[model samples]
Target chain A: MYVQEPIAILDSGVGGLTVVKEVMRQLPREKIIYFGDTARAPYGPRPAEEVHRFTSEIVHYLIQYRPKMLVIACNTATAVALEDIRSCVSIPVVGVIHPGARAANGRTQTGIIGVIGTEGTIRSGAYEQALKQLSSSNEVISLACPRFVPLVEKGNFRSEETYETVRESLESLKQRQLDTLILGCTHYPFLADTISEVMGKGITLISSADETAREISTILYDRNRMASNNELPVHHFFCSGEPGMFKSIAQQWLGEQIDLTPVVWQVPNIV
Target chain B: MYVQEPIAILDSGVGGLTVVKEVMRQLPREKIIYFGDTARAPYGPRPAEEVHRFTSEIVHYLIQYRPKMLVIACNTATAVALEDIRSCVSIPVVGVIHPGARAANGRTQTGIIGVIGTEGTIRSGAYEQALKQLSSSNEVISLACPRFVPLVEKGNFRSEETYETVRESLESLKQRQLDTLILGCTHYPFLADTISEVMGKGITLISSADETAREISTILYDRNRMASNNELPVHHFFCSGEPGMFKSIAQQWLGEQIDLTPVVWQVPNIV
Candidate 1:
């Protein structure tokens, strides 16, 4: 029997933990290696070249684990550097964007789709192209929610002013009469209640994390990447920043504590 | 007189652009330096240390451009690294968490508030702490909507399935019987419609982006960071990923056209 290798997941920071959560829920038997570049995060605002350099370095770092597959849990890195990372690593590199686009395409009624994401993902037009390529008749309206991830990370999910902000940001899109909306960034799912409230009853909200998780399952199944049932799968986490903060947050998000270790990466030389 | 300097707005990615749009609408005279780290994107799932590092990098990068004031448009970065970045930089740093928490605390009639966000932010208890700190009588129930960011980023803002996702994710929070919900993540604003539908109109939704913008304006005015009437405020965008992709989606989100430029940074050495 072939020995099952772990799945390697990388993000600029802890945002990718959402992806890890889904992976754990859906594929509990598979081991995981999660790497967060805590020392340098919020990859959305940097230059593409810098993002690419950062993504490559992280992927290179994760490669040492020799996981069976790779998940780029970050939308920005997926948008700017997924292809580059794929080329650099021998493992299959899966990103959240394509799976998300595919999921959105699968479920549109009026064909008018709305997307919200970080400045990088929305600006990349990767989803637009993917949706357009998938179906020409579909109309995709994208909004760059540059603050959403930050807001979510800050723990301001339910606030009166947050609703007003939602109203203001989405007022135009609501007017567009879109039937479906995509949560382009991984961090957005946390605001599902507020988003649903603003968009009204009829509009649909699609989560890229769910779609990406489903896609990962499908891909792994097709590639026979499932782990053997000989022992419990080991999930390991490494952050470029403080291990204590990462561990605390990871426990809360995952609802169960896992081992989180700190690994410093030489950011200066990687770029 | 000092030359007019642009307003600097930064997020992990596109979510902060929502704040930029608001700032533009509320104050058209201001030039804006909007940076979306399309490269690293979505700080929601990463560790606090990494989020802090990424936040500092962007803040430092934005400072190089000499903006009048800085708006930390992301809640996650604001919660984890705002103070650190503020200390490192000379310019005034504005984060969305406190203003948003204040807004929620002020609007709750039942004194029962529900806060949701990415795992890291929710775990940090920033909003909950801020809300409770403001009013001990208020009860805050915090949950992490891990899937929302990716869904919004992928452009699936409203759909029947998305509604189902919203319903499933928020089922527990709804049981808490809270009157106010904070759109903790800037991206949650995009999902406001669906969320409102699930929670009903009786529940008020708040967004940190709008509140943060107000706070930013107030700070700019208080600190005399407001730009002078000189030349048309130049709006510049820098992405760590693809400029073309960023521009197209940005146009959709901002409801206008923007010129996005790509920059490359050495990632390996920095982190």
Candidate 2:
């Protein structure tokens, strides 16, 4: 409950760095402890039970830090594990799905919204359910872009190949006449530019990453647990696979803020 | 905590209808009980204690409705009475200020944000405090547009005089180079078109009324208290002065939604 306690965030792979970047920018004073199960890489094609267990394992690992809040930054994990983790946790637990859903519902002028996510996220229909829970009249068109996670996992962001892949993946969605599109996967923000280009200027892209970070601020402030630290906070990063690519993407995504503070790194075992 | 119970919303005047409209759009199933202190409109120039008293009186009048939650849909009243009301209420009480501030902080690329509200809200420094709480580096430029609320109460949303008044009032803020402008007052959303025209597309306007509705959805869903009523529930309206002006403004602001449901109206005595 201490204000100085970090907000723990967990994702299947480096894809969750999108949420990390937003948290760093939106809540600068609050320290963070993150876990990226990069050894498992993409959880998109995995079974629900396995994703749930992996999330729980990461939660158990991060709980040792005694974070003020838990952010389930991966949409796949959030679709299955948010309630399970919330039941066990004493502090507030936020998921990527609901925040993005709420933001999209609020911003969407036309109730005909489009959602793009990994196979796991879209199949789970988490975004649709979340959106419907807010407003019943929302007409949701959901598509599973299974190719997206691997592109981000390998750090392939914004290339001719990437653009073509993104363009083809979004081919069907472009014709839906949707005014708002929810990037249902946290990894999607890394490819936001390519997606934006494919979707064109008429559609607004709602990043679950940015919205989740904003929700973290709202929940923390509501609970009176916001950090009052005046200085820049040093954040801790943990990954299950090779640290090289993870560190590079982490640094590139986070930019100057991570440069200001030396990161504490750890590579936990795949449970 | 029955989900079917209404959400009690109170404001200094008709400005809160903006929030009512958003709530209807965002959380349609939930019933609403609104109170507008029209007899003592323009709380901006009043003392904090008097504003607090008027807010408490309306809250008391609305509390008899046995609502599930309370929404302080007035920036001036929220500045002076939010915590006071929260301490005395059993259900969740939401104020208008922080939601707008959070949205602005999350969306601002340059850390410089502008806020426009009633005199009481600006004088209370609630927006700056809320913004700074999320990110310490934010440079907040705030202005109290004392002229804005009266125009809204009188239902003067758009006109040449209104545009001229808005332009002249915002002349100083135009030079600040702010990337985000928070319509910190709930009433400002009524004049959002004029405000946007004056501020230009360079600055994004954050409407507290819309953000507050979004926040209400978030909190209710988080608490597992969302209303499941498939039918549009009827809403109740109360005012301290003549019902003619208040009802007309409410209908015009709420439009088709209020037309679908028969509203129960009351004019409560000023305490």
Candidate 3:
């Protein structure tokens, strides 16, 4: 089938906009359907079982749209729910961790890589496991920057409060003399300036957003499922939380105005 | 299903060893079953319909082993047969072009990229289309280096003859001032030293082998099909043609001993 179905992407909040920006850049001809579970914003502190349930709920809802593929743009959700969602859906599903690990592996000069993400993602050890799987000799250090996400959600990214929080949170990692660091959380890129400022120019930062988009393109092209050239692509955005905030952040990052709808979770269909 | 199946990879000739080397490095725990169509080597010069038929036949034969996924490690086969084979098989299939295009897109600073591959791959215009889809403004220059494959296949990569061939093939691209070049064929990386020398230090080379390996890692990890740690990986190699040269190249490139089995093609099963 020459499927022209929209590609679906989801995250815990606006953090996934990082990935959305890349998808727009890499696959401009393909339409996208994005959902941000901003109402329950931080999946980081939630239990793995609860996170899985919430993510599966979103996936089930997205299935109604008949998306060609699924992208778990949130790191915590990806760590907890990627496989569960993949099994539930026939279409291809992608997560951020492997792409992040691959990028860090390619970028690192000293064989020492550092990753910073939410408490749940860091504790999950997904990045560490992936990096180690790629190269056993790679020394991986993971830290949880619990405060970074809230700072981004509140649009306090460039504020003095955000800078101080980044400085204090990354104090330990700063001493590691690492050559590469992964912004493991999808939302972390918003605070990149502060993070880069504190880490110095020497430490290369790897964002899985770009890598994930490339993987998406690869899957689409190889399947001959890429969108036809005659039609224009339309993007749909939805958020479980306040639409205004999500719209503002998304527009700023994407450099285009987006119409966002506030969507409440409906009863998930039992499969 | 908790799939423990090995990933099956194929190429028209020993050229696909470049991809196999990267897969082994990136996913050390996953077993790989590889088939080299050495008897019908150089799918590049063959007609598209013939290449598709040959690739589908190899894929059908490999499917008997019940592989979890497939990787079309040859550029020509991917250009001609990836979609057809994907539809014929149930498992996920990956190809080299999109990954290579994505890499070149990411690496190019001048928005001008160059691609070198077999005549078939270059003539297919897949890289140009992909690059343009990523960015309509990107300037794409594609060249077919038909002689490079023969040089690698004969184990004459570093010889002066190979250097002169690269210098001559790349003369137009060198003058184009490209900041990035996609080594569009899998066989080309074996001759990377000579190609790089010809292209000069300004052009960054993108090897689809590494990118394809990363995509495989992403697909396997997302599907929860990653191998268990309890089992040690065993590599299996097959060649439709002479095994001696394939074995020599495989061992030298992978820096490990490989046992290559010679297999003659049986009548293909009609799907």
Candidate 4:
């Protein structure tokens, strides 16, 4: 049955909304199924096995909807679970990491790329590896910003203390004299000002979400997954937690109303 | 057993690292179990129920480690899940929304507050409600910039397009003529420049994360949760997704080495 299948977008929390927004913008006619596992967020600190399992569960839940494609909007999940999910699912699985890395690699003029993300993401060296694999000339300098996420989460974007933290965090990267800085973590983009203030106008900051969106566009186009109709798409959201809060936030972030449903997933046995 | 209890810090993604960094700096002797659900991130867009569920799951997962307290570093997650988590867990649950709202309420001269966040977050009206609850004088004008998260996620902090998106998103808010702009979504902080550039120099941007961190410090101090006794606090990272990617980004964002371990959780049945 050639039904109009929805594209599944999953995140640890609302971070994946960035991707959903893009899908709406780029593929306005397609149906979207978004899932935010907000309960166990900040997946960067967890073990790889756990990440994979969590990702698998989410994917399994999403697949029940029979999505045409899956977009792993979370960077931590993309880094660790994308491959696993891809292997497990029959639908095409896409992630944000590679697209961001590729975008950073393309934008760097001096080949000195600076990456900022959660401790787990930074420690993984995914960007560094991607940069290296993409090109030998690009030098990746990564810094783990354990506080940036919290700062942004708390909405401390322009506080003096936030600036101080950004200053302290970027001191080493500033010393490195890099031209491009990759906002490796989806949340790091919220700290752009503190980072830009610290890094100055000479350096460029790249957001992984944007790159990932563009990548999704490419992947969909390549696979003929783009919606054929020109009508506005129906974006469905499922939260394992709270529907009202999710609707409110999704509306705010996407600048549109999204019908959100609650899905009960069977928690698999954890070893 | 006199064993050091781990404090759990959770966010949608890497942004919580900012809080983690502060905890590390302020409570050097304490142990932090930082979880970034990079797999499903940017909780700013999902439904409240999902965010609550995700937050609850993460809290439950973290509680297994027997953390002394929990920090909801992501503003959206905090806005949706804080009270629920607090009710469910014995540990003190701290969220960024109240602190940021309080700060903005205090700083607004015209009693008109402008909030920017991911579509889901802004739509939740959590900040608006919080600001109003704190003081009736505070009139909140919220705008959802769905693109901001992706821009920040893709590390397009200083890109021309990013600036343009910020300008477009703020155009409606500018009409409100508010003196204070609340960086409602944790991800919006990355677009401060674009926001500032468009909003001009007179406007003040409040970050929820910074205020939340400050609040956390205060709470810890008051509750004696702060680390002491000349012992250095150790921060441990857990990711529900990719450890390598999480670690790489952590190194870049937190400016330190984070050992990320995966914790697999059963996706609890959501009804």
The DockQ of each candidate is 0.01, 0.73, 0.34, 0.01
lDDT string for model 3 (B116-138, tens) is 99999988888897788767868
Per residue, candidate 3 scores C-alpha lDDT tens digits across A31-129 of: 899999988888899889888988988888788999999999999999998867767778888898878888888667688999999999999999998
Candidate 3 Cα deviation (angstroms), residue B163: 3.2
lDDT for position A77 in model 1? 90
Highest lDDT scorer? 2
* Local accuracy of candidate 1 as per-residue lDDT tens digits, B125-195: 98987665444567888989988877766667778878898999999987788999998887787787888
Q: What's the TM-score of every candidate structure? A: 0.49, 0.94, 0.86, 0.48
Give i-RMS (Å) per prediction.
Answer: 21.3, 1.0, 2.5, 20.7
| Model 4 collision count | 156
Candidate 3 CAPRI classification by DockQ? acceptable
Candidate 4 wrongly placed segments (more than 4 Å): A1-3, A154-161, A242-245, A268-271, B1-271
TM-score of chain A of each: 0.92, 0.94, 0.95, 0.89
Ranking by TM-score: 2, 3, 1, 4
What does candidate 3 score in Cα RMSD to the true structure? 4.4
lDDT to native, each model: 0.75, 0.86, 0.85, 0.71
DockQ, model 1, C-alpha based: 0.01
Whichever of 2 and 3 has more lDDT, that candidate is 2
